[model samples]
Target: MTIYLLRRLFLLGTVLLGLSIFAFSLGYLFPGDPLQNFSGLRYLDDSTREQLTLAYRLDGSYLQQYLAFIQRLWHGDWGLSLASQQPLLTEIRQVLPATLELTSYALLVSFFVGIPLGILAAIKPDGVIGKAISAIAITGYSLPIFWWGLLLIMVFAVGLGWFPSGGRLGVLYEIPPQTGFMLVDILLSDVSYRQAALQDALRHLLLPTLALATFPTTVMIRFVRDAMLDVWEQSYIKTAKAKGLSRLQVLYRHGLRNALLPVIRQIGLQFSTLITLAMLTEVIFSWPGIGRWLIDSIYQRNFPAIQAGLMIISVLVITVNMLTEILHTFFNPLARKR
Candidate 1:
């Protein structure tokens, strides 16, 4: 196990090295001068230009620039955001939790909800209940997330007024950030109308959560249903049934646990992707998450922010993938053997 983990760590380091190169090269590889794009200034005086060039190490060769970039990163310097002129890491810290909260809500909804529906579907795939779940899941999975978000906003937020269209909270609730998660922040703060603040947060959360979760929930339903069905066909499942075990007992005790090993892997795979995928939903809802932050940075041509975002997001995605792999290997005997 230790040897396997070490191998995985080496692989992770190799991938990070490659990703860093790709991220670092973007400034030079792209058409526009990064400084001009970031600075938004038509002309730069020689002294200012020289300073900027030195700061970003644009004056150096690619290898030298990359080494400087790594050195600065080693010292915990992620560069300054051109838009805010603050450390890029500091800006990320403010927004990343929002993305995590939003994505976490969506994941919870999908996991708990999808697994039961999947088991039900597996039990009676041809029945009306099963057919209904399958149809809804397929349709939800098929639709584009942005379009789905808009459709939801129209019906729930605009037409029906059941929920807020966008943002984290109503202007009435001035809850200061205790933790980045809005719900937790609401709970922790000594705001007036505290319960109301939380209710507003949920209302603001619903539409975006629904839109973001649709794809994953639907996918989970199909995946779980299929996995459970496959598990039920195994000889052990038949043996349990032959032993006169109740249908429910066999399904729960003998089937679900085995099915879940793969489910863990699937959900972990979805983890990083959902964060990046939230970009569209974030834009439509105007939620202040990493996705929206990155989008705004791009619009402002804040190349430093862009670069930081790329590197940060790359690390997150790669780290999640690596963890998923380790988790899968840990759970599956066949994988561990390989």
Candidate 2:
């Protein structure tokens, strides 16, 4: 297992190296001078452009620039955002937690809700409950994320006023940021009305989380259902049943562990999609997160922020895939033997 882990780690490093190179090269080759976004200033002059270009190291060859970027990355310097003139990492730090918090909650919703529906559907594939689950999954999968978010906001926030329209928390809550995660921050803070603050945070979180979770939940349901069905047909499943094992016992004790291998792999594989969907969900719901930050950077042509966001998100996606692969191997004895 140790050797396998080491090998996977090495492979992950290689994948990240390639991803960095691709992202950097794409950013470098992006059409438009880095200073062009600043060219509209009344007092901006040629020397200023030259100075800005030099400051950004645009004066160097592409290879030289890439090497500098690699060195900076190695030293944990993510560069400065042209928009804010602050460290890109600092800006990311402020926004990343919001995305993480939202995505985590969304994943929880998907896992808890989707898995059970999937199990029921698998148990009774042609039954009314199974058909209902299938219909729900299809609808969830087919709905556009922005549309779903808007529909949710209109119904829950606009019509019923059950939740706030946007933002992470109510301004009334003055929770200090220890972890940057709003829920955790609220729980850890010494603020008065902490319970109310936490509730407000959750209320704000609910709409976006549901919208972000929709597609992933559907995907999980389908994957789980299919995996369970496949596992249920295996010879061992029949043997367990014939041995007088109860249906639930056979399903839980023998079937589920095997079924979960596919689900586990899909979770990792679908992580990037989840992140992408979260970005759209954030935009629709006006949630403050890296997705919104990246959109603003693109509009402002903040190359450093754009590059850094790409690198960070890519690394996250790659890391998730690696972890899922490891889990998949660990769970599957056949994989271990191979």
Candidate 3:
């Protein structure tokens, strides 16, 4: 197990190295001035341009700039945003937790809700419940995320007025940012209307979470349903039934236990993708997350922010995939044996 983990860690390092190169090269690959934010302005003079270029090493050859950028990266310098004039790293620290919080809520809903629905779909494939479950799954899978998000906001937020249209908190609640997670920050806050704030936060959370979870929940259902069917026909499952185990035990204990390998794989695979999806969801909901922040930076042509965002997001996805493999090996002893 130790050897396996060490090998996996080494592979992870290699993958991150390759991804970092790609992330950095992506800016150069596209046609745009890295310093375009300062290109045409009466207030900006030649000496200022030279200093800015020198500071960013943008005046140097591509190879030198890349090397310098990497060297600065090693020293924990991510650079400043051309748009906000804030350190890109500082902005990432502020925004990443919000995204994580949003994604976490979506993932929880998907995992807990989808598994049982999936099992039911598999167990009673010909029944009314199974057909309904399949229809829901298909509907979820077919809907475009952006479209779904807008539909959700319009229906749930506008028509019903059941949830907030966008943003993480109501304007009335001024919870001091403690952890960057709204739900957590609300609790940590000592405001008089703390309970109201908490409720408001959850209300703000509901629509966006539902929109983000819809697709992944459907995916989880399909994965579990297929796995459950494959497990159902296994010899051990039949034997468990033959031994007079309760239907629930025979199905959940014997069937779900073995069938979970694929589901585990799906969980890991889905998480990395959820980040990408969260970007669009964040925009639609006007949530304060890295995704929306990146979108704004892109629109503003903030070179530093854009470059840093690419590197950070690429690393985050790769790291998630690596952690998924570690989880996969942990769950499936057969993988360790192999």
Candidate 4:
């Protein structure tokens, strides 16, 4: 197992290295001088602009710049964003947690809501409940998240006044920054602070969470339903039924357990995709996260920030894939044997 893990980790590293090169090169290849935007903002004379270019190591051969970028990466310096004039790592660190929190909440919502609905649908494949579940799943999957978020804000926040329209917390709430998660910070703080912060955080998170969760939840439900139906048809399920086990008992203990392996893999893949989706949702909602930050950087042609964001995302994707592979092996021992 250790050997397998190490081998996978090495492969992940290589893949990330290649991804970094590709992302960085693409950013570099964009038309126009990358320093053009900086020219207007910095108000530097020609000599000074040249000096700044040299300072940023931009006045170099493309290969040289690429090599230096990789060397700096090795030393943990992701370069400074020309727009923000901050270390790319610092910018990324500030926003990554928010995106992660959003994705985590979405995944939790998907699992809890989707899996049960799927199981129920499978158990009664032709019943009203199953038909309703299928209809909802299809609609949810077809709807765009941005549209869903806007509708949710309109109905829940604007129309009913049940939730906050946007932001991580209310301006009035005093949330201590612990681990960059508002809810966790609240829980760890004093009661007065905790109460106000928790309420604001939860209220603010509701719409975005629901919008982000919709597609994944729909996908999970469909996948789970299919898996359950497949497993239900297997001979072992028939044997369980022949032993006079109740339908519900057989469904839960035998059917659901075997059906979950595929769902688990799908969940892992969905999580990787969620990171990307969270960025889009964050922008629409004015939520502070890596996604919003990356979009801003892209518009400004801030290569460092873009590179850092893409690299971080690639790392997340690779990590999730590795985790899913391990989980697949664990659930299906024949995978390990092969």
lDDT of 1 by residue, 125-198 (tens): 99999999999889888999888889999998889999999999998878888779999988888867999989
Error of 4 at 291 (Å): 0.9
**Candidate 2, residue 242: lDDT:** 94
Q: What does candidate 3's lDDT look like per residue over 173-291, in tens digits?
A: 79888889998888888889999999999999999999999999999998888888888988998899899999898976878788887676776678887999999999999999999
lDDT per residue, candidate 2, 1-338, as tens digits? 88999999999989988987886675546665544422222234788767756754667887766676677677777756777677777888899999888988888899999999999999999999999999999999999998889999999999999998899988887888899999998888887799999899989998899899999999999989999999999999999999999999999899988888777787776677888988888888888999988988889877667778888898888899899999989988888888
Worst 10 residues of 4 by lDDT: 34-43
The reply for model 1, stretches above 4 Å from the true place, is 34-60
Return the clash pairs for model 2, or none. Answer: none
Q: How accurate locally, in lDDT, is each candidate? A: 0.85, 0.84, 0.83, 0.82
lDDT of 4 by residue, 118-141 (tens): 998998989999999999999999
Once superposed on the true structure, which residue ranges of model 3 sit more than 4 Å away at CA?
30-65
TM-score of each: 0.92, 0.90, 0.90, 0.89
Give residue 136's error in model 2 in angstroms: 1.0
Query: Which 10-residue window of candidate 2 scores lowest in summed lDDT?
Result: 34-43
Identify the runs in model 4 with alpha carbons over 4 angstroms from their true place.
1-7, 32-65
